[model samples]
Target: MTDDTNCIEVVTLTPLAQRFSYRCRTPLPEPGCRVHVPFGRGERIAIVTGSSPCPEGVQIKDVRTVLDQQPLLPKALQALLEFGSNYYHYPLGGAWATALPARLCQGEPLPTPKPELWKLRSDATLPQSGWGLRQSELLQRLRRGNLRMTELGSGDRQRIRQFLAAGWIEAARESPRLHETPLTLRPEQQQAVAAIRAACGFQPFLLDGVTSSGKTEVYLQSMEPLLLAGKQVLLLVPEIALIGQTYERCVQRFGATAVAVYHSGQGDAERLRVWERARSGSLSILLGTRSALFVPLARPGLLIVDEEHDPSYKQQSGWLYSARDLGLRRAQLEELPIVLASATPALESLYNRQCGRYADLRLRERASAQNIPQIEILPLRKKRLLGGLDPSLLSACAETLASGQQALFFLNRRGYAPALLCHDCGHVPHCRRCSAPLTWHRRQARLRCHHCGWEAPVPQRCPSCGGDGMNGIGMGTEGLEQFLQERFPNIPILRVDRDEVHTPRQLAERLQAIRSTRPAILLGTQMLSKGHHFPDVTLVGIVDVDQGLYSADFRAGERLAQTVIQVAGRSGRGDAPGRVLLQSHLPEHPLLLALQSGDYGTAAAQLLRERQQAGLPPLRALALLQAEAQRVEPVYAFLHAAQEYFQGSLDCSGPVPALLERRAGFHRAYLWLESTSRPLLQQVLGASMPQIPSLPGARRVRWSLDVDPQNF
Candidate 1:
């Protein structure tokens, strides 16, 4: 017989077919609480998913402890996870792992954050006259009065450490709350704010604004009314690089105590603290990257997705999922208002707006009253270029720098050269693991694969012809940075790329340098675009943009348009009017011409028509069954099994090799299923997929299903 009172269902970070039933000493712990439950060899930390009935003849072990005062993930978020896991076709274990911080997964206790107070110790003697400048200055600051450590900035960490170690300072716990002055909203911004404030239940709004249109200010103002009502808000940005600046802006307006920033870059302890603030109902706002979507909210009143079109929102590896899609699902589940703000909104969101699923909020003018940058396309045909730099562009950059202003060179690609070619044999070095050419990185003095992160030292000569005719081909951010440095010797060139800025602190430092008011050049990959606010950068030059026009990927045009708009928007944010020089071999491409219209509405309409005709996403649903194995035959067999099972209902493509046929030594192939009817597609998946694992060749290879696949 089943012991209903003693049995509880627990979920761990394991790919289980279903939740396990465990015996508990007391009344089943709250459904969302963290419990230490016995697994194979040891105890594993797990979320108590729900109650269960003990099965006959089963020996279930008792849970050791309930680690939370309450459920870490509340009922609302739990419902969200359930829906997202099923929708994305991700395992419940992996989905939940993504929800909580790494520390919480190790069966450790989620701690309560103590109030931080620092005071000069009562037993400490006055420092002698021999103190160094750093110690001396720190002591002087401490002598003023007891200080709250929260008031300290980034520069104060080292000093605070020294003081605490020397017994010159002591910390005490104190409860605190905070407030800050709000910026005045313009008339149009007020209207947008009014609309957001009036949102009652399950409302989704698209804050469609141009660059420097003060959309952020609107986001802040809209949050104000909700914060005053003691409600929490979630603000999601596309990248970790943006979190520091956004955090600074939020802390300045809401006060540090009211705002919390969470991301993977943060240490486990720091992430846990942010989670504690969010869960305790003390934080008014939680701002961070995609994973921030899962942070538990006690009173989530609104959800805001900044740069909603960004590709980073889609997790390409390990339980591929889209945060933007989940955000909408969460809002609908909670019946809360959600505002997806984007200077260049995603086509999916645009399609929804066209179909009346989302209300559109537009901010057309620049917030500073500066005119949008005048864009001039410089054709790369038959022009005398100085190391890939058109003389005209250089002259403009010289003028901008001489006038004590900044110029930003935007290149989406990183490394020194995109490829290394053997002129003698016409051979190119390619990654052994992936079917892609290796890029030559000059600074690292190596050839690297951008796709799979494979790298090797540059060869002495061509491996094919042995002619010593190896030549660097194509331009990248490194090549642009080097050329700019040689031409503009006096001005400082700050190169911001993945290679240069690995941490958030590095990003913050580079941003700080740009704000110095000195004339300097900013060079980088897509990282320099969109998120940053560079006021004095009056001249913006896109060294390379021709590549995105005709990519194999269908989303290329939309992504390229967003990048162009965002990169150009970074300039002219200050009092000075900005100018953008775009270099392209094909100057009059329809997509490029459409950009002159300013907003993406016209281009979006065009793309939508094309997508509808072609039966793509937003008009149709897609699921990619990707299979990989050391040997390729099993992959094909497994996918063939899946295709045969779905048979006539869903249209399946491939069992063809992937774009990069082999990645990390595994040959990959994808089976794509598309359908105009979503329910029919879901029904087909629900009907026959459970039996595939036990089928022939299924165990010989690793495979996953990506529902609504964002990438190939």
Candidate 2:
């Protein structure tokens, strides 16, 4: 017990930015190790962030017990977390705490990785000749050698369990068996891979390729050399649904032990295994969504963000950090090459490319030289819509179906309808907990608020008019599927959305069904738009294109353009040339025109120039000071004081209400801050962190500072 290691600074996985001091006895736990320490009334297993000698006049409690034998977070990961904490203006404790699995924080011992091997046990009796073929086959498979658990399916599991129960088998763990799938790359893909390999350090490359341009192939090809070196690669996608195909592909190419998945969808034990694998450098690739960026790697070689522009990459709640942005910084810190591949790049990334911050690698030609989808703009002026589908677009879908080809109807909204309207009084149903209308889910027979997730049973009569003439006003994907079913009667229509597919297996089954069914009509929301290749689909019909044209948010047009191109890109991947029919009320809309001509680059360029002239992002930096309360006045008062706190230091916009002003029973408002310089804006926010929470009405509301806000 050295006097020099007498006290320690602890950081809990909580919102408090303040670090706590605790006395330590004997050998102190190193930084990044976990310790169970007394918090307010109970105990919390906190991370040891720093340590020093005991203060002269302080009385502090000692750390109860060390929870880890070695450091939980690597040095590089700790440094990256520090940078993220300062940059996002978030509490390091919260980010650091959330980085560990929930079980680890709950004082549960870290779970050990289970050996995936099973074999026949010694001294076990052999089955007699009366064994069934299924039992015989299982025994024969294990007789040859111990089989990896990943090599068997769910049905095979029962057989293996029966064998184990009969004292015929035992489990074992060993080094991960290595395997590699051979592949031939196209000329352009080869060049992209070579360029990435030749990079010196901290080089950012934008794989600005079109959808179905073999970007994944290029990513995999580039990783081949690094995987052979036993170095780890970080692959980030936008959503959990997208992880299935990518994970399967990675595991198939490099064996099951070589790949580990990190995402919120997995259970605690599963996530812990991946965390252990990542930290131990046993994983060749750590694949996941936004939160996986915090996972420490033993030997990181490359970072790849597929669909970098997708808004899902931005964390919305506690830490409003961008995985793509952090990946760039992480690569710089680690001196590794990174790739940001997207069909429609974000305006910020594009601006970075324009400024030469990122090398623009454009793979113009599709791998197989498949023809680009032909786009047609169908005007909806004076034309009646049946479930939001234009007559011309409907006819095109029917023709494609008759020709034994698939048809995809891309509509970004779910549920049966947007609102339940009363014919008598022109009244609409609204949510009590939110300042928004409740969408009608026909299957559930309920009105659901998309903003706050509050649900209500469908009323037999309109509340306002006390009339039974309640009608659904706007059609959604659910209603579209129902309508298409009635129209076709003979063909199958499958709807894909958050409501339909809640699991990876469900989504995989839906996709597999779509592949097997020809002349089928597929209806869905944005879930079907990103990173999906349906080669059999020869036609695409986009409904409700006007919804994004009049959005209050500035980035709506940019997002719409990206989605339009991505949805259109889903077609024409097969041998036959495909076409996309877009139904729009404003036929001449610039974004529509860009999509009609199949050129998103022009739209992105124009949007960037518009942002520059308007003193918005990519030109002038911005941060949002958001506060919400159960009562409205406290929110406005707190924001007004915050605006005053930054009066001359930075320019402040209104203590205005949010787009959806009141959500989940909280009245929200924000003060918009802008600056020509990024550093100055960040400095202003950092300076105000202490004062904003101490404002007169601060304790009455929930508040946060969103740096580089993606939403309005």
Candidate 3:
């Protein structure tokens, strides 16, 4: 083999579904390191995957500079990425791009952690006569004890660097200091923690705990041993909003230096720093959202997915992968333990427990001496609501506030109203780019489409009929907040939602404000529902329970139940008695009646039975081959042509319009594939997927395949 034609395999940050071959000189960079390579008359950064022998008579481009001296990702993390790519049927390059931080993908220099402390080397003897006075003094201080580099003068720091090069001094590793003691665990919590701590390898446990049942405490205690033994822990939450409070709690238990938080909301440099520290085994614990699942853990000991059932754990776009499922695979690969903690576990998780794949650890009672919240349904049989609140619910909130406790109103809509209705013409203004109606944002005086992000000014008159009567049709958190403020003018009404709180600092401040204002009214979309602890929030009012009563998706019931239970969980967490009033038009609905029992297990079991009977997920394997384009015909034409390649004993439905047929100026459609056996489905997909892009209609539309998809 010619030395100049040595073949190397690389993957670039592109949507292409395969790796490329490049020829470079000998001594190539190891797999997982970033490399600059020539492509299409330009240079692009790529990741070195492996090497293969050059094909005879086949010309290839040369590799440019190697970005890192060593592999950026650890071996185990690389494996996880590869496994996720294959399982999700996404492109390998795209998978790598998603796994790595944006700066790394752009060929930015790998972050090098600066040492904080310095000490004298073991064998170094003081140069009594040859060294300068400042150097001698610095060495004397170092000999006494490790000194922080930050605490030294500039002259001393420069001298210390010289001593480091001369092998007279070395970097010192500081141990993490414990700032707080562990809280006393309940009996069930102790059992759960013991089970987790005693596990040897490759164990998956479902920490099924109710609201305020101390699941976090169990996680803390379970992680203590591993952290003390010099092992790292990974904790995944479902929301960016939750990271601030969770990080604070972890910092209180473990010192601030020992804990770090990563999410998309942070700056690129900050994320890269945390990634490097975790890869170097210096960070003791990492808490983050879904994207942090790919972060490299040098000493992987335990992985915990808080609120594992959350749909936020599933990536809805780009790479369709579930962090919860991938975390399980990661733990199995690293031979460690993983805990999936949730009050309302997903049906799939419960099924896995039933199938003996995961150990079930349950916490049935509240950790606090407070009683469980009383749940009731308020029937809305043509009852007029004051800005979407049932009178009974309003009275309950008033009573709770009268008792010196807080009340929360849960509304999953953010704007002032769901739509701008032309009352005179009986016509509602819809988004021109999508099939959905534009939401009315009264505060901003704009009509916004939540689906396509299309916005327009509120019409002074009906555009279609030239009518003057245009009004908001339905209630949202913003409108509800306004009405509540008018009703309880003296009381504080805080709105917690995406528009109100944008950063971790803002969220922290808002939460602190909530804590300070007792007997306050909190209202927001689902942003306030996940894992927020308000000890004084004794009442939770689910503003519109009927919104989710009917849906086209099969998992709608499960999602609805989970949302109700999760929102209801936010109340009655303190010493005072708690209550939840789910205002519904259909109070007699089977799902609502089932939820009235306050037993998610029972509701989940019923939903599972329905799913099994309907041949849906947890009992069947499913994937969606979706296509979208500017025109409707191209989407259908592409999907129809793509459907002909499938060879399987499986059900292939669609070439049908999506639930939202139009979104963001694209006409969307999909092909649904389902099978009884997962391996057989994979086999069919593996054979057919390669031929999809080559079809004649493929170029007219953008298409992707989503395995185990959560969204319709």
Candidate 4:
């Protein structure tokens, strides 16, 4: 007989078929608690998912240890994980692993943040002679008022400890001070704020605003009511690079102690501390990147997704899931309101608004009173160009710089050039691992593969023909930077790309330089386009646009449109009027002409109609069964067999070669399953989870199921 009450279900941080049942002690631990249990030949840290009956005729081992006094994850977060696991067709173990920090997964105890405040003693005698430089500075600062330990420097820590022991200082537990000063909102912004504040439960609002249209201000003002009610708010950004800027803004509005920032860039200890503080309800406002969606909240009230249209929210690798989609699910589970704010809203979000599933909040005008940037298409046909720079565009840049304003050259490519071409044999270098060209990085004096991250020193002679005639072929950010620097020697040139900005600190420093330096030239890739406000940048010259106009991927047009509008929006954010020049070989392209009208709604509607006619996403559901291996045969064999096995109500496409046939030395192929009904698609995909793994040649190759895949 199965003992249902004494058995608990646990899941480890591995790709397993299902949860395992383990016999629990008399005092049962909660579902979200961590448990140490024995697996096949090893011990693993597993999460207690729920209670289950002991399987008949199975040897169930007893759990060795319960790591938490209370559930580590709250019930709301647990529900979100469960929904994501089933929706994305991912295992619970992998979902848990992706959601929590690495330290927590390794059985580390929850971090308790005990902040100490230090102040000078009232009756302490002066320490003039014996103290070192740091000690003297610390005492001098403490004479003013109390300071948090975090405010002290590393060298001052030892001196503070000594001073505490010597009765020269006193310490107490620190408390957060809430000093929220809400910005004065315009009428439209006030309307948006009111809509968010009036949300009773599980409401979704799409805050559709143009760049610099005060969407963030709406977020800040709406959060005030919730924060005052002693409820925590979660704000999810799309990038780690934006966390520093967003964190600074939040800290400035709500006191430093009230706001906390969490991301993967921080150390494990810091991440765990933030996680614990958030769960303990000590944090009022928590800001983070995509993964922060899983952070537990003791008193959840509202969820905000900034730049909701960004592709970064979709996890491209293991355990594929959409943070934005799951954010909505989390809000529903928590019975809270979620605001998805974006300038160029995602088509899915727009569709939802059209279907009346989401409330629409629009901020039509720029908050700064600056006019929308003027868009002009510069025809790149039969014009004398200087190293890919049209003379007219160069003149415009010079004019902007000469007028004491900044000009930006926006190119979505990085490195020096696309490939190193040999003149003697007309040979181009390609990545040894991927079937892609090697990019030439001039400053590094190396050839790099953007796809696989492989690099090699620039060769003196062509590998195909022993001739010394290799040169870069196409223009990239580095090449454009060099070309502009040579032409405008007097102006300061700043390049913002992955190569130049590796960390958030570096990106912050570069942004600071752009703000402080006038009459500067900024050159960068798409990293520069994500809601960065460059006030003095009056001119934006799009150096490249044709590459993205036509692609095998259906989302290419939408992505290109978003990029163009976002890059153009960076201009005219300051006092001066702004202008954008798009250099395109095909100026009459319908997409460009639609962008020229500056009506994204109309363009999006047209695209939606086309999608409806074509039976794409937001109209129909899609699930991609991806298979890859070092060899081609196994991948095709496994996918073909699985395709045959899955043949049923849903329409099944070919197990065709992937967009990139070979990447990182793996031969990739995919099968697309589509249905008009989402529930039906989910049903079909959910059924294949276990059966497909046992398909022919499945063990010889790696395979995964991507539900609502963003990439092909």
Candidate 5:
């Protein structure tokens, strides 16, 4: 037998499942350590997953170098990575690469910040002249005493910078104490907080509260104990915009140093800093988007997912992991409590509560005893449209403005027009690469494809028939914004959408602007629907609600109902009663009727029953095996092989075209794997995935397996 030192071999994790062993000149490193090792003739950053004795007379190469002084991933995270790899049937190394930030995977150095607190100079005094009304009031407050330089707003910053440049003000550095007073929670919020705190280990609590019901206050209160005990809290918001909003609240309650924000929109260095802080126990609270679920907390105490039912929680690509689901899993694994707060929870989550998997905590009454929004469904099937706004909606907007309240016009689509059609030829402009129509962006003078992001200058004449006249086929936010601007020229109109609010900073700025101006009209897509507090908005206009009534996707109706209720709920948040006008072709639809009546519970129950009868999710688990190839045959052929490989363990269906079959030059197809039992589906996938790589044209195709898929 060889000596123990001589037996040392470097086993590197490859994109493939099998770990290849190499000779180690130095001692074998621990698992999770990044090593520079020879792969063929070149070197690669290979993570050491294991080490084993080589076979007799088998030649091996030595590791070139160790990339890190310590293991980048901890043991628990390593296990989670392994679980993701096996469950998704993806390459182990590829899965690990996906779990880490791109900067870390690329071996970038972490950032070092020399934080210096800035204080108002002794010579500095508040400006007494040449200021806007708002700026003048703010300066008057500052005249009482010197404040932190960082505490000023953009407007204040500009004024201060001007003052400093003119020698009217000065700057100084001093250590500043971070402090904030806790806001008082209403009785219902207090009760909700009490119930959440009472729940001990591995409990799932659903905090059912309307907008401005003080859910955030309750969350903060429940988190205080965890923070005091030196434990970390994971706070997940639906979108990056919400991340900033939630982070601001956390900062208000727990100071800026105590909270770190994480999301894709942040710089790599910022993400790395936050990651390190969370892992090192410097950050007690992490406010982030969906990916924050993977952040390594030194001592995790609580997991909170605000707006738990938001579709943004479901990742559309890569591993397709649902952050909401992963949050609950992490809580269970760590034996910690988790809270899912939502005004309208997804039917699946509601079912979990019904089945006793989650403790239901209800905040039935609004914090300030504000009444629910009064909803009115305007039947437009037999009515003539005036710029997609009915008389009732127009009159309501006029009335709302007359009463000195804000009005919101919610249109889900975002372009100038959804499609451009030739009136004579009955033909519409379409994207060459994607199986979708090109939308008209009149402001940009372009035809854009939303799906594949392809764009081109809009042609003045129709390409199909060389006709000079072409008409926009459908209305979008741009059209609504223009129409509203024309109709209510005297009223200030703010349009919020992906196009208008391109960044988190922009979204925050616009939100701040809207809050400051209470009598403005807000028009946009789903961005105005959820997680925002608009106390002054007393009117909501849903431009169209018929899109989901006949949608092909099974969950469309449910999502539509949730979105409508959420948008409408934004109204009537203050003292005066509010009103919502829903324009729909199918005014008598059951879902619309339920939503108009503010009966989400009844709607959710009905949806759950339908889902159960149809063998949908929550009753039956699903895994989607999707394949894409340049040629359609390869996709179908591979899916058929996978279907055969699964055999009897799981029910297989579809070698059918995906929702959008041809996208960005690839033909896509999917195979649905269904099983009442997760273990059975897991077993089937475990057996079948091994045979996929050897299938014909496998190298030319890309594929992914989505377990418990939220969308198809």
Candidate 6:
């Protein structure tokens, strides 16, 4: 280390690359200090990771100015970030942008918390007369003990207002106490908790409990020992919607001040505050989505990933990192124990368990002793359907509603209609730039492409033949909503889909309304499925299950099985028994039969055998290099050159048309790269990516490499 002043030169953190570098400036603070620097004619905020001698004879820019008076990120988080950048093949600076909150990245100052308190006056005493019934109850409770300011109810507020005006009660300064009572756990839950508590140090435990088997209770119990040891805990959920529910439960055990939420939904200021709180050791528990894995804890001891198999845990955009994978890695690095809680574990996780990479802990029986929902298959080929609902499903919904219970209709598609067909000429409206049909959006009076987000007016005549006789074809969530509205004119019907509910607040409000009013029917897409608990939902109808079974993607069957199970799990959560009616053209399909019998183990075994024989994921590592250009030949030429570059180490296939070959005026083509070992594939990609980008026709097209792609 040099002198404090001349020790560091210019320190800069670039958002474009997420790299932290230092140049000789006058004198600078220590590494980890935040500074402002001149970057491309604009000043941006950056952190100093280190100070080193400027490279001789190389042009160097001096540090502009220092931003934070103190260091923002500690050494541990810096190491983790460096690991993530190299592992994900993403820019270091870009990873930091993802790790830090938006406000901090934009150079906002940290906030000072304004703490408030409530106290009873010295002369305050139990009311002897002239108190309203509600006020009297509140006064009696307060007489028994001291009450915090924020904890006062409306009745207490009214009485307090009177007392304050009369100078009979006074407010005092005290620390905030925002704690609630924990729920009573069942015996099985207690046993699961005890077993998890007995484990120590860097252990991997899988909590394979049935839906509502009190898996969360096991998590809470396992977390207690870690927290008691003064260690921080990180809880990862699949979506932001889950954060609220899980956060509430955590607050009930550990006070509100101990837990903080991190997600994209929060405003910049709130996110920055939470970030500071987590970093400063003001918060002990952190709950969030996949990105939460990057949170910098003061002392991380335990990492819990709830619903470990959910695909949402794997971020498809940007860095393309899997949160579940990172959780395991982070736990190992920190020498901490991790709990992966899931009803149906992913194949990769199951493989890990089989290979002794993780310890298995099964909560085989339901904690509450509730029976699983009855699953009935309705063969669509033999039954006449009305607006996607079969007679049996409709009858079930009617019976459920009549008994004062709720019903849910699951249709994965969301637009009003899937396609518009011309009756006169047998023509269909297709997206002008993509090889796919344009969906009709009745509310918007336009045909929209879900993939490229292209929209156009609903033409009165077919473009091919100028025919006026056209009709909307196939059922979607919107169409189903219309059908249910007309059929049940007197009952309230709530449609929960991407189009209807766009925000977490909207989804929460709709769910709350459904819970309060148990007689309504919920008609929507798979958005209504996954993780929501509706105790009064006695009936669930799967509108069309055949689409998943016939999709070109190899993982379609697995996805369909997971989705069917998740949707069925939503029913019969309470004491009232529930039923599920699945409508499919292939009712006798092996996957469907396995699902109906509640035999996920058998289904997974069969799928694993098939995957092994076919050389799919978990057996081989795969990557996809996609290229798109205005003309199709350019993509082919680029791919051909790429194929020539990787001569022997890797297997190259497919310069074929992508699933949707044309999109937004571009023709797309993909080349598949596969290897039995991950290291070999990484090496091939590392060597070939730079060369492929500079090939002929490369300048005229856009390309990206997707490692472990979920969709083709």
Model 6 TM-score (2 dp): 0.87
Residue 690 displacement in candidate 2 (angstroms): 1.2
Q: Indicate the TM-score of model 1.
A: 0.90
Residue range 73-154, candidate 1, lDDT tens digits: 8788889888887777666877888888888888678786554667788898766777887677667777887667667776
Q: Is candidate 1 or candidate 3 better by TM-score?
A: 3
Which tens-of-lDDT digit does each residue in 83-126 have in candidate 4?
89999988889999999988989998887656457877788877
> Which segments of model 3 are wrong by more than 4 Å?
1-5, 127-145, 153-156, 647-649
**TM-score of every model versus the real structure:** 0.90, 0.91, 0.96, 0.92, 0.88, 0.87
lDDT, each prediction: 0.84, 0.86, 0.87, 0.88, 0.79, 0.76
Task: Choose the strongest candidate by lDDT.
Answer: 4
Instruction: Write candidate 5's Cα lDDT for 559-580 as tens digits.
Output: 9879988998888888888788
Order of candidate numbers by lDDT, starting with the best: 4, 3, 2, 1, 5, 6
476-534 per-residue lDDT for model 3 (tens digits):
88888889989999999989988788787888899899999987999888888879999
- Alpha-carbon shift of residue 562 in model 2 (angstroms): 0.7
Better of 3 and 5 by lDDT: 3
Worst 10 residues of 5 by lDDT: 169-178
- What are the root-mean-square deviations of the candidates from the true structure over C-alphas? 6.7, 5.6, 1.9, 5.1, 8.6, 6.5
The residue-by-residue lDDT of candidate 2 on 40-154, one tens digit each, is: 8998878888886766666678788888877888777788888889998899988886677877777787667565679888788895778997788888898898898888989
What's the number of clashes in each of the models? 0, 0, 0, 0, 0, 9
lDDT of 6: 0.76
Poorly placed runs, candidate 2 (over 4 Å): 1-4, 113-182
TM-score of 3: 0.96
